[model samples]
Target chain A: MKEYLKRIYAMLIYLFLYAPILILIVFSFNASKSRGVWSGFTLHWYSELLKDRQILSALYNTILIAVLSALIATLIGTAAAIGIHNMKKLKKKVIMNLTYLPVVSPDIVTGLSLMILFVFVKLQLGFLSLLLAHITFNIPYVILSVLPKLKQLDKHLYEAALDLGATPLEAYRKVILPEIMPGVVTGMLLAFTLSLDDFVISFFTTGSGVSTLSITVYSMARRGINPKINAISTILFVTVLLLLIIVNIRMSGNHNKKER
Target chain B: MKSKWLSFPYLVWMLIFIFIPLLLVLYFSLTIRTPDGLVFSFDNFRRFFEPIYLKVFLRSVYLALISTVICLALGYPMAMILAGNNFKRKNVMVFLFVVPMWMNFLLRTYAWMTLLERQGLLNTFLTFLGLPPLNLLYTQEAVVLGMVYNFLPFMVLPIYSVLRKIDRQLIEAAADLGADQMTIFRRVIFPLSLPGVMSGITMVFMPAVTTFVISRLLGGGQFTLIGNLIEQQFLFVGDWHFGSAISMVMMVIILLSMGVLSRYDKEHEGGGLW
Candidate 1:
């Protein structure tokens, strides 16, 4: 009875976690305009999404910001991680806390601060500023994700590479890079995910002409909850779930191999 | 020589990007915007203590506190199970928990809108079961639900990390001594996991205190949190000074909580993020 109860509890929590998302997925295919009942399954909304210029443009904007922000964040974050890793005399704990500020700082603070910064500098509030703000937060995510790997790496591999007639650049390229590639990949993926999903900072920094998918979704949903929004949300939910599954499979496979 | 110059670029970036902007916010928080563009005054800080703004601040704290408790209630058992179970399905469970974090939070809250709105799925399902339709959206309840859903994984992940590191023999010894399951959990598991609980509470509470979008979108903008008030000051009212003050107040609350948690961790766990 105890075991049965525990199983039931687990199943119940799982259902609770997933039921809303699954409902959204199912209704995204409803044929009727009303969200009241289960209509016949149809691909109409998906097709409509393909032709909706504003939605497409917002998606385009999100992609643009995610790509640019992730790239910039990856570079800066990798450098910070390497620098912190090399600082043997410094207090590791204090540096870790400082590195965490960007991640843990309230988005409202980050957004407001960036907005005020751009205003003071007279920089135009648009894609570029959004890109800068996104990168700012994204850098810390990368740094934290990559730091553990850097800490675990063998220092003598680089030393050996240099001892074996390799230049500094070549030693780093041939030895250090491969050792840290897993963390780097994970960091880049995390940065990309964060940049794609961020709304508060984008809302504050986005100018008149550019807006992200999240902001567009917010405005549309706020005006009135509609089925079209469901359509977009369903697509987002499925895409994220699938991407995560693939990433996990790859990560777990690597982890299992290392354990063996 | 060139390597020495490399530090200059990073230092310049930090000063220009982070430090200067934060100092400006600090300055603005201590000033008032007048006809002369700006004046050094404490009016903005003083104004935050007014009843209406203070109520908003309290409401935000209350909401965050409630959400943190809920996340803990839901997250702890799950974390314990994940840490203790060497089952094949553990990866799948972990994947389920973390995958939701990848979806945009706004989109997830909007999904709640579909579920909770009048004439929406929940009400429709209710009517189908020979029951009356229930309107649940646009309430504090809905806002808290949105927050828990968004932050549960944050709570779970850290707790699980800490739980996984705990020595299994301790639990076995407790069981071998004939301690009941509940007692073992309370005496063994709970105390050991307090670090994660503190981290999780900090994680859930900080974001919950300042969350504007979920409350605005899911709570119908009726229940204003500190974050919503801050956003309103900047966007709708065009009062940057007031907004900066609210932002600073939030920063202080978060820093105080973090400081307390870190000090506690130092005394207890020898200091770690978990």
Candidate 2:
């Protein structure tokens, strides 16, 4: 009886979680524009979504920002992780705590503070400001991911590379970089995914003209019900799902390999 | 290869981006713009004490607290089930809990607008069952529901992870001592899971307290939470000083609550959100 009750409760929770999404998915396929009625199935909305220039541009901007931010953050953060890894205890503590600040603070605080900084500095609240904000928030995550791998790194590996007559830069490129490649990749992917989904900071930082996919969706949502929004979200939902699945499979594969 | 010089670019970047921006906010919050340019004053902080803003702050706290409670009530049992039980798809089940969170949260919140709208799913079901179509959206209840919906995973994942790490031997020892399931859970499981519970509360409460999107779309225009207030200050009203003050207060609330929770949480485990 208890087991049955638990199963039923789990079912209810899953239903609660997925019902809205499932409804949206189902509604996207409905021929009718209104959510209330389903007048047979059609790909009308998805096709409309394909042709929507505004959304496509938003999508373009989202990918562009995410990719650029992730690439830049990965480079800087990997280097910082290595540097901080070599630091004295007190200095490491201070820098690591600073790193945690953006992670721990509410998005609104970060968003508003960055907005003020941009205004004070006289930078326009557009692509550059948005990129700056993304990079700021993203570095901590990259550092956190990379720092652990640095901890796990063999201490003498770089010295061994240097002893072989390689220069300091070459030693880092050949030895240190390869050793932390997994962490770097993980951090970059994480930064990309976060930058892609981020809305709040982007909403505050982006000026009148700029819009990521999320910002566009927010406006479409606020403007009222549009079947096109439903279609767009469905595509986004599936894309994220697929990305996660691929990552999960790879992670499990790595876990298996490590066990071996 | 691990030279500290490598960190120079990053430190400079952080100073310009993260640290200095925060200091600028502080500078703005503590001073007012007068005829002589920026004059130091506590006027922004004082304005936050006004009843209207105070009410918004309280409502943000009240709703977040209620959402946190609801999440705990719903989430604790779910965590127990996930940890304490055996299932073929246990990992998959845990992953499902986090999957919704990974979906664009804005889209997820907007999805609620569909169901809670007048001719939406819930009302359609209600009307089919001969019930009155309720004014469900743009209300306090809707706001709380959205909060719970958005944050339930934040509560569950932490508690679930902590619960999973409880030593099985202790439970077995309790069973050997003639403790029933309920007693074992209360004495052994629940106590061990308190750290997770604390972290879970911190996770849920922080976001729930700071959310502007849910309250805006679901609670409608009239429902002004602290997040909305700060958003208006920066984006709409252009009152950076007042916004900075509000942001400072919010950070204090979050940090204080976290400190208190962590004080109770002796052995800090990895919080589940990461």
The candidate maximizing lDDT is 2
Per-residue alpha-carbon lDDT of candidate 2 for residues A134-217, written as tens digits (9 for 90 to 100):
998999999998998899888988888888998998988888898788888888888988898899999888986888999999
lDDT of 2 by residue, B103-188 (tens): 98888888899999998888888998999999998999999999999999999999999888887999999999999999998898
TM match of model 2 to true structure: 0.97
Candidate 1 similarity to native, TM-score: 0.93
- By TM-score, the best candidate is 2
Which ranges of candidate 2 are over 4 A from the true structure? Answer: B267-274
Worst 10 residues of 2 chain B by lDDT: B265-274
Most accurate candidate by DockQ: 2
> What is the DockQ of the complex in model 1?
0.52
True contacts kept of each: 0.47, 0.74
